[model samples]
Target: MPAATPPAPRRSAPDSRIRRMIRIALRILLFGLLGAIVALLIAVFVTASTLPSFQDLMQKPNGQTVRVHAADGTLIVALGPSYGDWLTYDKIPSTMRDAIVAVEDRRFYSHWGIDPVGVARSVYVARRLKAEGRRLQGASTITQQLARNIFLSSAYNYGRKVREAIIALALERKFTKQQILELYLNRVYFGGGSYGVDAASRKFFGHSGDHMSLAEAAIVAGLVKAPSHYSPSADPQASVDRANVVLDVMQDAGAITPAQAKAAHPEQVQFAPEPKQNSVRYFTDWALAQLDTLVDEQTAPLDVWTTLDLKMQKAADDAIRANTPKDLQGALISMENDGAVRAMVGGTDYVTSIYNRTTQSQRQPGSSFKLFVYLAALEAGVKPSDPVTDEPITIDGWSPRNSSRRFLGDIDVRNAFALSINTVAAKLGQRVGFEQVANMAHRFGITTPINTHPSMVLGTSDVRLIDMTRAFASVSNNGNAVTPYGILKVTTTDGTVIYQHDAGEPRVLVAPYVAAEMTDLLQTAVNTGTARAAQIGRPVAGKTGTTTSNKDGWFLGFSSGLTTGVWMGRDDAKAVPGMQGGRNPAQAFAAYMRVALQPRPVEKFQTDVTLPEWQLEPDDEAYYGNPDQAFGNEGAPQEGDQPAPKEDVAPQNPDEIDDRGPPAERPQRQRQSDGDKPPQLDQKWLDGVLGNRRQPQPQEQPH
Candidate 1:
């Protein structure tokens, strides 16, 4: 009786607190399950809404192929829309399929497009590497990569990643696994300008994808990660190493035996010979770079008409190949007076080096920069016949010497320029403030930064060859500004004009008289100065530029209707023995010009001497009126009164005066601490009227 009563009281259908706790736990579990179910439904709906239809997938637009042509419609090269024969799933060998899966996506068959395990691992690695300050690595699966490659840009971010995941999941749900794999294999890039597995097999092994061996398949699979870095043609050993990795992965995945992988590891890969018709590859590359800028959006195949003259391009390429030194590189660019780039040779060989030196490289212009200084002086009322003493003088601590280390007592400004005299140029730069000279250069289309340093007059500042050529073109076109242009028009395959260049009226850069005078002076330089070798059978105006240690040599000149510039230098900036602007660069220019000007009629430069030559009157009072002024002492002697030679004058050769460097074994003066400051002219010499009235004393003679 006692036991029954206790049991009945104790049960009491459990305590109130325990019962309430159980009810609360059940409610929470039920709500959580409902929430999770709703979330999954929403995810499925969103992914399905974003999925491309079967028809949309089938009608996916192929990448547009851009075909670049010369002005005359000669095809230069073609890029993109490069697809091999369509590969079906059955045609793909198991080795090829498994190799891609093993290396690119380990859980391809098990995961639903996105692998959570792989994502977690990638997050951990990315965080660890970010803390160590390394470049972020990717954890993209094959499906994710395909989605980005086909539908999105290569930009990597959380937003893009999320979108990529959604698209990948949608893609997996819409297509069969085999179908997705077929699409990926057909769309993957395999380097050497190849776009698919079949194309890659043909390019690397000179065969079809169906006939590829296990090693070949592995090699092709490895290139999907980085085509250029693992191209068998460019770097065979790197391709082999990457292929070995793929083979190991395949063996681990049970697709291939360990013994089979070991046997294929040491096998040599035979690559096809690269095509020799890629002569215009560099030009095509440059044209492609400009395509986006020339057109807003390239939605279809484009027919781009370039400014290239095929005949001139061939001549320039041949000249550069035949004349350039074996160890050095060279570039040549020829353009019309209005800045239409006619022929451009970016380097000695486009296959060996893809850098466009004509448009990309910046090097010291050497004496070629003197053209700007002389032009500035002319604009400032300094005449070609004006007398300038070429004696050794020190500015602060820097004393620049001529190549011969011998100074001419007095010479006309024209002769000084023809001989590329460093001192006369420096003095002229000082007389007309360096700022004015820099402004004048900027007006003529030199975009490089110019420092207000005395040495800048001697061509110490670096400049691109194209800009320098444009500056000279301004002088050739009678003071008109020239803008260098390449593309003439771009048309889509549907005959719609995407871009058409309108050649506008040339802008005047300088006064017509100033241009004529500069042209005359440049003519003298090519006729009798360092650029003598650049002379063709016609009248030409050009300047020779040789940098210190013979590191860079340039010949920038213009004929009546065409302007061509040649640059020769080593890529490493190492000195080329005995190299000068008048040597190889001049010869190459002459060779190219001879052929380029063959079909065109020779035109003469218009000699319009409207500006009168500035005259200096010989008077003790008016000439020396501004004795305290640093410059603007206009009344120096005209040309008649010859200055007597100083006692310790050294004989100099006119031929050697054009050298930019000092004589062999002669030490150059230490550059002044105030080298950037303008060199001060001696007022006493200006007062003495260039040593005509009395003996002139230099402010500071060179040691």
Candidate 2:
């Protein structure tokens, strides 16, 4: 009672102090609550606006795809850096499904669009492991994986994790679990420039994803965990170990029996043949470059179906690889007149380096570009028999000389073309209008830059290898210029028809009559010109080009059903000394064409019904000296003034090829480097045809 009385007298100060403290605490708590409310509102607004649709990203358009083959299910070339196309969920392999599920989320099917338990367990495990000084681990479900690949950066952070969650919810709302899983399967990286499972399967195993074996599926799935770290093709043991881990997880998750897991373990990881080692490395590399200019990234396929005849290609590749000088380089291309890429070889190897001298290098075409000049002259009513001078002439201080500086004063147009006389081409170009010749080349599908100067007649203009192939195709297609393509159809993941390649009516760049005359000229070259090296037993026509200093050499030719061109040069435009197109490139072309025609009937040239006026003058000088006398039964041309030939000679057919078999087989080819060993003129390309399915180890691509 006494203590209470004393407290009562003096308790006001204590009571007042208590009240002040309580008020301050309340104010601080209230402000924190207000701040949190503002932050929450901002976050909600930002998330609402920042969220994106998964479909939009999944559908990016690619343009003007150069398929390098027909739509009939062949693929020789692609348009983008990624060598792949998209596929749908139904085609996914069960092995891949189980493997990924076991590794990424054991209870994925049971989760209700989200896996809270998985996340919690992962956090717990992560903490335990951290305590034990181990690496961190994840607990992402398939939906989460899809969310991350589709909408989030690969970088790990708390903020990104939260965003991934929000996006995962959005994805769940838009697509079912199966659909999400499908997207994840198709979108995951599998190393080796492959973006999706379909591409991964084709690129690594040379087959469809649906056919992947359990071991293959495990390897593919394991790559998702650490693509560079566990790429089987690059690091076999590491990849196998990761695959084993996948098997262990599958066993733990009851996805596979222990026996199944053990059986699925890889004894050795075998990779699909790398392109660099392909016999058609140069051809493929060149075709790929052209496809890049034509097709867009999103629309290209994982497996490009090409116009290449695998059998023919293999033969050509083998012959060239066996015959070419080990240190020199060469390239070859083949296609049907309808723009189907039949075969190609950039160099001995295509894996380590992909620089295709055939398409990318702009070395002089030598005599190859003369086809257009001769064609343009034919269109101008210049007869094959007309004589022209092969004497040296100067244009803008540029004097043109022949490979052998001796001029055959008066030679027929056919003989000139066949012999690839530089002087005659220069003289003929002056009469035909340099611009007209350039335009004719453009019409014939020479999409590369063509120099309008008089030197254009000397093949001085830069031309890509594919463009040359297509140009030659015109002769085979009866004057129709057919654009080349590789992919036949491209569909979205949901089966929406994204693209279907359809051949348009032929563009008549030249009259069939003119094509016939051109064909005859090329035939003459095959029969008697430098292209003699290109002669096959069947009726074949081609031109051989050996530029000045031997910087570049070319052989462009065709048969009734197919057209092909070969190019040989250095990447730096350095002269290859004595190496000419007829040496390796032309021989490769001949080798490929020979086999390509074996399965089919021998080709026959189709001569034009209407022949141009034939002038029997001995040389261009004689024709120029007396233009009136040189007129044939058709008399002088009815059109513009007859432009007399300068000091030059006649046009000739493709120089009759030596019609020789491949150069005596040089040293047997070892497994060539993946198209990376300095563009060797190695032999193993599509044996000689342009369109051959690469026998991955041995089996065909689709089989």
Candidate 3:
């Protein structure tokens, strides 16, 4: 059937003008679309150029960071630049220069501004990657990248491509091939807050670009592909593998000999973590706070000079926060006698809250305030062997009981203060005059809303951790109370000194001998008393304090030159389960002191710094008389008796209650001393304080 169709030759048909017209229309349509795209690119460039200059993307020269040098300007923290000091081409190590050239663009030096062969290879790769739905990722020339990062608008479109090409050409024209390459090397961003080879060099290798090793240079060079993904500082082993790839590329390009490349690749090159850089973040924060305060928040910014030993700060914070328990949060403050806060930790993790709890939270002094009691007592000429009565004495129907409710018949004052005997302190407060004790605390820098009542003997008034710290620091400074000044010397970004710290002559609240005796008592507290665990091998002195219900736990201590305060508790005022000042705060205090004293010359407090003429002898009569037995001896069901908690409420460690409470809200109980007593026992007071068992016998236990 098919053979019959060959008979007639098909007539040559005339061209169909309609079809030609359609072809013509199609061509016009393609051209129109091309023209539209080109027009859009031109418009984008014109608009972008008029907008903010791309130069703003590069760093500005505001000098935000002022290099706080060591006494020798040893580059503690670079004050201004986002990265580090710039390095010129000649200063950059040849290994890095070659590695980057080899890895990024082998023909960078030989290409006539563009590498066609590389581009073709890249096009192949991009097409392959695109087939898998890739966005056509890079093989970008350093020049192209620099043009993007420093000059291009970064909109990621054809317009940006056109702009990048123009800038690359412009750069090529403005500088020699080597100069352009150098600029590219210096302008590329590296992860870890670094820009340029110089910054990347120091940031990754802990050295300048001039001294970078080949392995180190390769690591930095390889980072160009994906700084965040490939940074050596983030993952060293992975970076090393990438660096080895760069080394092989360099060898292939003949940029370095195989032997030289092999020699450059170390067994391993680790990019050191800048732990100390952020280690003193607390100090940095404190200084920055001062900066904000001293000058306008926006302008006239002050540069701060501090006695901050960043390395020591790191060590101190690291040690102190190491053993932090799950139930507790701790804060630390380290200061010199001159009121310079050298180190601080706001909380367990400052990344969580920048509150700087060390200087902010105002907590009760507990027994730590008892130091002032001893301080005032010694100034009043009380001897270490002085004795006070332990018997239950009613000061207008209010009886302040001992911690254990068992009083020794007779004890010396020194032992009394060291052992934290509450009744002995109450009796001593009566003799020393509670007003005088309050006045002594004032001279020692505890200027808070101190009630100036008998309770002041047990530190019931409110005082800040910073203020309380300053009080101890004052004793460390030989009884010279100085308000802590974290800002040492403030300067403009240009290094002009604007404000400096200088607290006047020492305000001696207690005589030299009196202060020394108190210091000796504090030392005993560490050696054998509540703060025993905080002993720092050296002759360090410390006192421990806890607010009621474990809301605040404290340990304040000092070495020969430095004083530190540590507090642990819940931020929300919820009790810390079962914490005690001597339990964890003391442990943290000792650890921090150990690290802080590493570089210092080991020394004890000056024997003559503040020697108290008055000795501290424990009062034996005050503590050791059993309370249960005493009450039982007086007959069990007296009409005016007290009911103790059935569950005992953990015995209310008078030490914990000594500090103004988190739970014992309302005005704290007054002391049996100073003619002031726990408020006159009205029926209402008894009902609330000791639940309504008017029969006055122990109530049913909670258990």
Candidate 4:
């Protein structure tokens, strides 16, 4: 004790103070190490308790993926979790793997999941950036990212980081580095509604991940940070820039040589073509709306097979874009005679307006409504050769004028329909009774309300384009009723059928003979009447409809067993100057059919009845003005027929608007001199008269 006291007395004060400080620091360090160990244990316990089922994470996605496909199995759009083929580590291209590792975590191979050096560097940089008023950057390694993507929510916080680190460490113990990497690549989101590198590779490169080039691999690897922002389809320039950064990182990480990195120009990458017809969204939306009705609760992924024909859809979109005027909207719906919808374009731009004019909008069908009136007359035993006066007539107080303002006084029922004579349509509606006309419309699939007003004969009632298309499809289907459908089948990924379109026995809507007669009249209309613009060098039966104010122009026709309807108008129903059914609408129909029908053989309308060619009549206004001086008294009302009412609205003046074009554009009927032969279906004369007699291509077959 005396020796120790002497030694302590001789010790320097500074040395004693330093020893005390060292002892305190050692104690503090020891406590800190113990505390960290305890905290890590607690984090491990909590993370393990909250971890997702490994089997489920490996086999099942969180949400069901709904893949909508066109009739030919072309992918239209993917709705939910989009995962491609599960690629093994070997199946993944080495370039793609290296690019991901280089960009995401340079020390991925050397680190044991939780990279302390990377974490320290990331923390330092984040603090430095935070002090400069920047957003904090994360230090998630590839293992951490996989853990978060598969097992944890993407919330940034200290607790989430702790959990991610614990999970990452556990993943490192459970799987090899390559296994972790394979899982990571298969689970990452790569934008464009795609998930996983393989899906993204196919989506962007039109091939699997195994075939990716260096540039493509870099581009795909760069998509992980901010997928939407770096998407090649959304922002090509940004994607290229980000991909170059990935290449630089790869070179720095020694995954790629500098020369190789420099040679890999992502800007020159040829990405897959963008989806052709955005109009397919319209059909997809429609099909999805009916999905729940078709199947039970969607608990698993579904593979939907829709009736949409991609080629026909593109053709329809192109036709509408080419023909629709600026600021005006157009809609088209095409279907098989059996009512399977082949194509639909709701508007000029779907992103601008999603309101489906084909099914949602109801507009007056104009003279196209005459289809029901004429059909009713035909059902009532009126022959196509029956005499019908196109002269001015009033029903109650409504006086309908011919579009040309000058009527062909004594034409047969066939020519009357071909010329779109309003007076004759009105007289026929009255002759067969408005109730019968409305009944015929309902029978032909007009679901909207049809007022039995006298003026309704000129298509005053509002109808949907789909309804009109379906009605015409019924006529094209030899009088069988049609219900328009878009979905062919819905199945699961395992090839289990969920819903199959049951094309049940068609309901007989009209007599085949009556439909044939109406088809003949419609053919005559297209061949020599207002709808000559709709000619496709084939026999087509259709009608033209122009509403009172030119607010709606429509052409509903059928060729080669397909029925299509086109409508042009403003959403506000404002008049479009000089708009007519036989003009833009018919032209659009022709344009679409030119492509839609290219794959099909020409089909003639099958009918037992044929109309004999009529003798040409001169414009004898004086002879037609006097009813008694007409060709025959048959043009007058028969026994028990209702009397024609006096004119209420004055005959449309020469300047009045009509379903046909302006007065100046009206064709002048060549006067047949007393000694001249009757007019024939002269090709040159018809071309000069109708101004549109060109033949388009053939027909199309639905896949």
Candidate 5:
């Protein structure tokens, strides 16, 4: 009864009740807003604590400058302070400034530090894209980009973005809008190791940014997104395509008229000639890696002289690009007989990949490895004319067949090597001892592990292109071991010689007579054997090698005192259809050699080796019957003896005997009555081959 009476007396209007509730809600919202602002301020201060001072940030990055020069003292590249000069806002071309704004940030001029509109739009777009399983997009202003380039890394994460934003706001508070733009123009990266608009303009157009044309400005602007992908020196057409997009965006932003944008023929803009090959970047990287080992401290500037021939580098680059298929990659290493690496093309293009295949990659050398095998055999006094049976043979439990899947009954060592006869090589490895072959490789400067399996005679082990090039360079050098060197000298800005290459007396690894015999055999290989495609109208000696399934192709040889090795394969070690050493790799070798040897006079090999005089019976049709035959010009298939299939015509290109041969389908050959015997394995003979010479140690190569 008491509660009923109090309720009746205290009845209030519904409108008043609603007004009271609204006031309570307003207080809660105001408090929540204050808490959020305080939390944001704390985050900003914490991020700002890790930033460098504004004045310090304005200075160049903390590192000593390194100037890399070619063999002729031509400046190849500079490491630090790569900018041409600090360009003021007025000195930058208006077109370039406008193009950067149009492509990088549409609201650059209107925003203080962060654009709320851009942030919101980017968030919405990012959410929508995430729903479709796409990468998140960024909404960075020019100030933010400057903050990242100067202070932070290019990492993408909430923490990094928060730090980036804090630094961006501090930059806005410290400088005027024009000052910010000036700093950006002087510090942004423009690819090809260029920093700043002036440096990029000078590098690409051979001029300053102050005089850039509209199209050239657009090209430079387009590189901001991805420097390497749109590098003018690497891919001119791609730069033009990206520049056209920038032009369209600039026109849409009202920075230029439609007619002006349409008239901008970026496609016709001719870039300046690069003083160095993109491959030279690979060489510089290699040289730099050894710099730390050579110098105790890098606190001061440096001047590095490297043994890179621009002409030869250009030729090597062009040869690989012109010969290699689009989907594949190739590597080439060319060194003088003295072991100075003249030209090294690590891959087809350095911009797309930084891997130095010449020094880093280890792939099967295929039959190009036979140089060691034959050298070992020659050291054992097995003359090039010594007869070896090419009939099918097995070592241990493994049977090695020829790539042609057919064999000539008997052939001399010279033809067997020229044809890359696997059976004969297997027999020779067993007769000479596999350990001797491995010792021969190590003596020739091969540092990689060499497995002595019987199949090792067929190059079953992997080797680097540079090492293989050195092996052949030793042969070309008349049995002298080679240590491939790239850097000629290193000095400080004041000309203090910090490091200098020692061109010491050549170390003898193989006997001169054996090397001479091997060279003769290799010459026959390129002149009339599998490497016929490698002939450059001069005395050239090299071998062709293709691996099983065509996974790798190689051609290693020497011409005119210059030794080079060419290798073509996929990174994944997959098969490249229709690829053969004699076809692409040998062609590449020939093309490069033709240009490399142009400036030098043609030279002949040493022919003073003392050996027994021997001659082939004749080029009798009955003996050298089939041009496709591996050997046996004197013997043809007899009655009921089937002719070898045409598919069995070995290109003498690669390694391994075909594993697809049928045991019962083997072709029968006319046997010869020659009573020559194969070299038998004997301890006395082994000791005589090794002699009293010391085994050569693996030299530490500088790449």
Candidate 6:
């Protein structure tokens, strides 16, 4: 009975079998885990093999800085890459290196390029933060940071992180610890357009990195996490607080004693005076903007030899600063007769406002636009001495009035233009057809669209100051079309020319006589008209323009050698009370030109066109009026005096006169004589000027 009871309590075979299976399963799982770790190591090794060679790593491409030089080889500015003199590991102070390590990576020397413990901790924190919906913080070592900045784009993703880690490992294998630390210090960004520890040290302390004190080194090290946020220039107090944290960390890491950390932490940091952020910044910006179209590619650093004359640039800056009101803004552009931009002050202060009013702004030209209208009339058989009534006039339901609101009854074309009579310009624009006026402007290099309204003659159309200055240069250059250009030549640092300006054969767009007459007319303006204030004691020709409500005032003028344009207005286009083209703009023009043209020899305009007698019919009272009464005795010639005679006019047959349609439809007249036939019009020039007009056929006049 006892034996049978004991047999019943015997162990189950199934339980023993289950225990054996559990042991086998545990052994298999352990092997599988080991295989996975080995596979991961192989993947990491393969990825690291793709890294750059040691030489390639050492010669990594940092963005090149662009150096802008004036035509005479004076440095205008240096921009683009914010690099400074490269420093070797030996040149860097031990204190500076220790400060960086204490703040950036405490175990920098102990860890293999990628810190496994740091990565694991970062993953754990990241998981917790993800559950709580927080921004993921970075746990990159200095080596990892250098790898990203040197070889990778600033993309934050799993794939990018993997590549960054593998490259960091490769960097550790190829370069010594000191070399890695040196590279990191040389390539780190340090706010305010500074790159590298040397630049940062000099920018904040006005001294080289090797000469920095413990406090100064800590300040530089603190900026590594967030350069802009901790910039001393932007927020000095915040930057000081960040440096204190670095000092405490240095003390804990035994890089500095507690007393030393305390002494350095509270020490006042004297930062260097901020460098003139962008001297001639507006000009540099505009020049670089043009470089995009001028050069085929900007693959390397370029030495841009600009048309800028630094002396003239300084003059323009002084003139704008002295003449422009504090609240209001202004722009000045000075150029050569061949369209070489010599000086450009885009705004009163490039630091306060970078809006380039000279090249970017398109304000109303006001009366300054009448030059084109008068030129169109001159091309259409109207002489500068032709009769022009400055009485009230209207076209297309739009009435134009003079700035003075008083009409100068009937005046000659020269006086009418000199006085900037809005009515006469409007009437002439209507007579010659607005299309012709627009064409004339286009030929003079006014690329802005011109409305065909009669008011366009009064400069109601908006135009850039650079374009307007270029247009006036045509008058100064004897009818040659002027194309405004800034960059003379662009070359690499090694002197390989990338772009060179070759102003091709000059395009004579305006008739020679027309240019001479236009110059004469504009000279009269500067000498005795609304632009008298713009005179610079030289043979100068210019026009004054005031828009409606005094919103914009302009003085655009040129001498034999230089052409300068000044614009004064509020950036908001609001009216500046009591402002006029003859006021501040004219004064600034005069001031700048006096200094700009001081060295250049004074040259007079060539008045070469032949003169013709004034032909007056019995009923031609409008052609010869009371000059004193017309011009208020200010600029009017003593009564009965006339401007220089025009070229001879060929007698027109009565039948041929009938063939000429109404004033608006008539083709531009040709110079004709008894023995000579009328010359055919230059259709190409005409078409270019008068956009898309039917070409006129050459016709013989009956003798």
Q: CA lDDT, every prediction? A: 0.74, 0.65, 0.65, 0.78, 0.78, 0.76
For model 2, the stretches where C-alpha displacement exceeds 4 angstroms are 1-147, 150-190, 193-306, 356-361, 489-500, 608-703
Give the per-residue lDDT of model 1 (tens digit) for 1-703: 5665444445455587799999999999999999977875577568768777654654435777888889899887877755677678899877889899999998999898899999899888988898999856558889998889877888877789877887887788878898889888878888877777888888888888876788999999998888889898888889999999999888888888988998885358777887775446666676678778778866677898998888888998998988898889999888898788888888987777778898899888888888889887776666666788988765444456666445667878876776677778878877776665665666677777876655667676678988899999889987777888889888888788878888785565555556777887888777655677888988888888887667788898998689999999998888776778878999999999999998878777654212223322323232222111101111111134232111121222112221122123222231223333222323343223222243333765555
The parts of candidate 1 lying over 4 Å away from their true place are: 1-37, 45-60, 151-153, 277-279, 607-703
lDDT of 6 by residue, 1-703 (tens): 5665445566789998999999999999999999977875676687567766655655535576789998899988877656667788898988889999988888899887888888888899999998999857659999999999988888879899887887787778767899899989888888877888888888888887777788998889989888889989877888999999999999999999988887785348788876664337777788888888888755688899998888888889999989998789989988897888998888877655668999999998877888888887776667776787777654554555454545768678877777676667767777777776776788788888987655567676789999999888888887777887888998988899988999986776666657777887888777656777888888888898777567788889898678889999999999777667878999999999999889878888864222223322322123212111112221112234343221122312212221121244222342333454323334466464545644345564444
Best by TM-score: 1
Clashes of each: 0, 123, 46, 3, 5, 2
Cα RMSD, each candidate: 13.8, 18.5, 15.2, 17.5, 11.7, 10.8
In candidate 6 the C-alpha lDDT for residue 134 amounts to 88
- Tens-place lDDT digits, model 3, residues 1-703: 5665557765454556677888999999999999987885565555445534333433433424454543223445554445566566787788878888888877777765556887798889988888898776666676777678766666768877876766665555545776667667767778766778888877777777778888888888889888888876566667878888888888888888878887876447756565543435656666666665665534344455667766657766775568577756778888888887777777776654556677777776666778777776666556565676556653333355555556555767766666676666766766666665665566566657665444455566767777778888877776655567655666766777777766765444434445566777777667655677788778888888766555677889898678898887777878665566777888888888888787788776544223323334434244322211111221121235443111111211111212111222211221133343222213333233323344433564453
Q: Between candidates 1 and 4, name the one with more favorable lDDT.
A: 4
530 Cα displacement, candidate 5 (Å)? 8.5
Structural similarity to truth (TM-score) of each candidate: 0.80, 0.54, 0.51, 0.56, 0.62, 0.69
In model 5, pairs of residues that clash are 546-653, 546-654, 623-633, 623-634, 624-633
Model 6 — TM-score against the truth? 0.69
Taking the tens digit of each residue's C-alpha lDDT, what string does model 4 give over 214-302? 99999999999899899988888899999999998998988899999989988899889766547888888887999988899467889
Model 2 lDDT per residue over 1-60, tens place: 565544445567989999999999999999999997687556545654655554654553
Q: Is candidate 5 or candidate 6 better by lDDT?
A: 5
How far off is model 5, as Cα RMSD? 11.7
C-alpha RMSD (angstroms) for model 1: 13.8
TM-score of 1: 0.80
Which structure is stronger by lDDT: 1 or 3?
1
Off by over 4 Å in 3: 1-279, 292-303, 491-504, 604-703
By descending lDDT, how would the candidates be arranged? 4, 5, 6, 1, 2, 3
Better of 4 and 6 by lDDT: 4
Model 6 lDDT vs. the true structure? 0.76
